[model samples]
Target chain A: MSLDQNDIAKLARLARIRIEPESVADLQQRLGDILNMVDTMQAVDTTGVDPMANPYDAFQRLRADEVTETDQREKFQAIAPSTEDGLYLVPKVID
Target chain B: MPSYTVAEILQKLESRECSSEEITQSYLDAIAKQDGTINSYITVTAEQALAQARAADELRAKGDAPALCGLPIAHKDIFCTDGIRTSCASKMLDNFIAPYNATVVEKLAAAGVVTLGKTNLDEFAMGSSNETSFYGPVRNPWDINCVPGGSSGGSAAAVAAGLAPIATGTDTGGSIRQPAALCGLTGLKPSYGRVSRYGMIAFASSLDQGGPIARTAEDAAIMMQAMAGFDLRDSTSMDVPVPDYRAALNNDIKGKKIGVPKEYFSAGLHPDIAAAVQTALAEYQKLGAELVEISLPHTELAVPCYYVIAPAEASTNLSRYDGVRYGYRCEDPQDLDDLYTRTREEGFGEEVKRRIMVGTYALSAGFYDAYYRKAQQIRRLIRNDFVEAFKQVDFIAGPTAPNPAFALGEKANDPVTMYLEDIYTISVNLAGLPAISLPAGFSNGKPVSLQLIGRDFDEAGLLAAAHQYQQISDWHRQIAPHAV
Candidate 1:
C-alpha cells in the first residue's frame, strides 16, 4: 500500500505531466494516501460480480457512415503547434 | 422579481407587464451587485445578453417567442459558447475562444434563453470543491469561509444567490447535486445519456451528464425540457424520448414507496444531517407515502470504483490537450515531447495531474487487469446493490454529503478525503440512475440535502417526489444570505 518516489516519476512520465523534482516526495506521500483510501474497497466481497465496463452496455446508435462534417483542416490546423500539408508535424518516428 | 419561476416569467412576458429586455437588465444588475461577493460567474456576457433580450422581445411582439425566451441563464465555462471564452476553468483554455457553440449552448440559444455569462468550476471539472479552479474559488453564500460544493458550485451559487434564474451544470460524480445541496438549490442529474454531451467538455464520458441547477424542481424540469434530447454528434446520446418533465411535477405522492437506505445512515454521517433527513422522510410519510428500509450492501465500493473508472476514462479523454491543437502552448520547446509535457504541466491543476497519473497507472499494460478490470467488477456489484434495492422501494434516500459544507481549505490538501465527500452521491452516477437532491431541511444554520435516486430515465418520478416535497416545505424558497 505504498507508492515509491520512482513510481511517481514513472507515472508522471506516462501522463506527460511536468512534476517539479522536489514535489516527487509530496506526490509519493499523496499517492500513498489515495491508494490507501482506495484500499477500502478490499473489504467488499465482489466474488461472482460481473464487471461494469460501461454504465451504458447498449451498442452505440451511430449514424450511417457519412461525411456529415465539412473538412475544417485548414482552419483547425491554423492553431496547431506545427503543421504542414494538412498534417501535424511530430518528431520523425522512423528516424 | 426575486422568486419568479420560469413559467411565471414567461406569463409576464405575454401580459406585457415585463419585456425581455427589462428582465435581462434586472438580472444583469442583480448579478453585478451579487456576483461581486459570490464570485459565481467567471464571465458575464453583457452585450450578448442585451442583444438577445432585444431579439426575444421582438419575437414576443410577433407572438412567436419560445417558452424560455429572454430568460437569463448561466452556462458552465466548460461548454463551448461561440465567440465567448469557454475556459473550462483551466489555464489551458483561458485564452482559447470557442469558434463554435456546443450543441447544448446552441439549443439553449435557439430556445431564446439569454446568455448571462460563463460560470466558474474546478479545472476541467476534476475536483469536488471549486478551490481547484484556476480562476479562483467560488464562495459559499451561506458561509463565506466554507466551500460551495463543486465542480458546479458557480451554477448553484448563481441560482441560490439570484444572479441567474437557472444555470446549466455538468456532473461527473456529485458535481451538480452536491453543490446544489450545499448551496441550497435543486439540481438534478438525468440518466447517463438523458442530456446530450455533444458540446459538453468530456471528463468521464460515461459518468458525466449536463443538467439544470435551479431554485425549484419545477424550474429544473422546465430547463431539462430544452436540454434533454438525442444528438447524432454524440454517439452516447440516448435514442429514448424525453418526456414532459414539468408535466410530471405533480404535487402528489400518495401511496409512494420511499426507501431509506441503511447503508447511507451508517458511520461518518453527521447528527444534524441525520436529523434533517429523518424530518424530510417524516414529511414524505405524512403525504400518504410508506417508508421502506433498504440496503445497498456494496455501497462502500462506490468511491474506489468511481475513482478508478472516472480517472481511467478521464486519462484518455484529457489526452487531447497535447499543445498540438488549440489551447495553451509553451514559449519554447526542445522537442515535440517537451512541448506536450511542459504545456500540459503548466495548464492543468495539481488535482487534474494526480488523476491523469492515477488513471494512466491503472490503465497501463501490466496493471490494467488488476486495477481497471477489478474496479469495473466492483462497479457492477455496487450497481446490482441498487437494482436489488429498487425492487423493494421506488427511490433510495441519503444525505448528499455526510455533513454540511466544510471550510475552504479543509479537504483541499487531501484529494482522497475530498473525493469521499462525494461518497453518497457518486453511486448514482456510476449506476446511471436519475438522481436529484432536494432541500430536505437544514443542520444548524446550513442547509441539508436528501438525494432521491430512481431507476434509469425515471426523472419524471424523481421530480414528482421532489416537487411534492417542496409543496409542503419552504426549504426551496429560502434565499442565500446576501441575496435575502
Candidate 2:
C-alpha cells in the first residue's frame, strides 16, 4: 500500500494538482494509509452482482430540441477570469 | 416565526402571518449574532436574501406565491450558484463565479426559497473534518474546541445554532449525516438520483447526493419535499413521481422491521455511541418496531469500494476544472502543460489533490481494469450485502459516527481512521438508498446520532422511522452545551 514519490507524482498528474516536493513524503505515507483503509473492498465477494452505475432506474425521455435561455453572453462573460471581445482568453494551446 | 420549519414557514407566508422580509431579516440577524463563533457560513448573502425575500413578499401579496416562498436556505459551496462565488473550498475555484445556478439551486429558487447564504464544508468535500477547508474549519457549536464533522459541517452547525431553519448539504460519504449527528440536528441523503445533480460540483458523483439539514426530522422532511423532484437536465435524475413527503410524516411505523447491522456494533465503536444506539433501539421498540439482528458481511469493504468508485468518478468529473474552462487559471504559463500543472497545483487543497492522485492512479490507462473496474464490481457486492439485509428488514439503524465530535486534527494525519469514520454511512450511498441521521441521545456529554437507512427512494419510511424516534425522545432538541 506504500506509495513511492514517482507514484505520488503520477497521482498528482492524474488529479491535475501539484504538491511541493517536500510534501511528497507526507502525501506518500498518507496515500498509502488511505489505500490501506480502502483495501477493505478487496475482501468482499461480488459474485453474480452487476455494478450499479447509477441509482436511477428509468430511460431518458427525449424532447424536441429547442433553445431555452436567450443569449446573455455579456452577462455570462462578466464573471470570466479573463475575457476579450466576447471570447475567453487563455494560454495558447498551439505553439 | 423564527423557529418554524421550512414547511411551517411557507404555510405562514401563504397565510399572511409574516412577510418574507421579516423572516429573512430575523434569520439573518440570528446568523449575524451567532455565526461568528460557529463559523458556519463562508458567504452570507444578506442583500440577495432580502431581495429574494422582497420578491417572495410581492408574490404573497398577490396571493400567487410558491410552496417554499420566502423560506431561506443555506447552499453548500459545492453547488454552482449564479453570480455568487461557488468555491468548493478549493483555492482553484475561489475565484470561479458560477455562470449559472446549479440545477438544484435553480429549482429551489423557482419554488421561491430565499437564499440565506453558502455554508462551509470540507475543501472540495474531501475530508471527514471541516479542517481541510481552505476557508478554515467550522467549529461545533456544542463545543468550539471539538471539530464539527464534515464535509457538510457548516450546514449542520448553522441549523444547530438556529442560524437558519434549514440548509442544503451534499454528502459524498457521511459528510451530511455525521455532521448532523455531531451537531445534534437532522440530515437526510435522498436516494442518489432522487435529487438532480446537474449543478452539484462532482465528488464521486455515484456517491454524491444533496439533501437537507434541519433542526428536526419534520423540518428535514419539509425541505426534502421541495428539493426532491425529477429534472430533465440531470441525466441521472429519477423519473419517479415525487411523493407528498409531508403527508407521510405521520405514517404508522408500528410493527415495522428495523435492522441492526451486527457488523456496525463490532470493535472500534465507542462505548458511549454504543449506549446511544442501544437506547435508540429501545425507543423504536416502544414504537412497535421489531429489531432484527442482521449482518452486512461486506460492510468493511464499503470504504475501499467507495474510495475507488468515488475517486474514479471524481477523477472524471473534476477533470473539467483543468484551468481551461471557467475556474482558476495560472498566469504567464510557459505552455499548455505548465498552465494545466501550475493552475491545478495552485488551486486545489492538499486533501483534494491527494484524492485526485488516488483517483487518477486507479483510473489510469494501465491500471483501470485492476483498480477501477474491479472496485466497481466489488461495489455491487457491497450493495448486495444491503439487499440481503433489507430483505429481512424494512430499514437499518446504526451509529452515524463511531464516536461523537472528535478534537480538531485528531485524525487529520490518519486518513485511514478518518475514512473509517464513514464506515456506517458510506454503504448506504454505495447501495444508492436513502438514509437519515437524527440525534439519538447524548454520550459522554457530546451528542450521538442513530442512522436509519431505507430502500431506494424510500425517504418517507426513513423519515417516519426517524420522526417516530424523535417524537419519543428530546435528543434532537438538545443544544450543544458550550457555545459563543
lDDT (Cα, tens digit) per residue for candidate 1, span B78-125: 998877888999988887778778888988888889999999899999
**What CAPRI grade goes to candidate 2?**
medium
lDDT of 2 by residue, B1-484 (tens): 4456676777777778888899899989988887888889989999999999999899888888877888888998889998899988888788888888887898788888999999999988988889999899899888888888999998888877778888899988898899998898899989988899888988987788899988888888888877888888877777788888878988999999999889999898999899989988988898998999998987877788888888778778778777765778888887777878888788777777778778888888887766787787877777778878878899999899898899988988777778888988888888888999999888667889899999888999898788878788898777665432
Question: What is the DockQ of the complex in model 1?
Answer: 0.60
What is the per-candidate TM-score for chain B?
0.98, 0.97
RMSD of 1: 1.8
Superposition error at B30 for model 2 (Å): 2.1
Task: Provide the lowest-lDDT 10-residue window in model 1 chain B.
Answer: B1-10
Interface RMS deviation of candidate 2 = 2.3
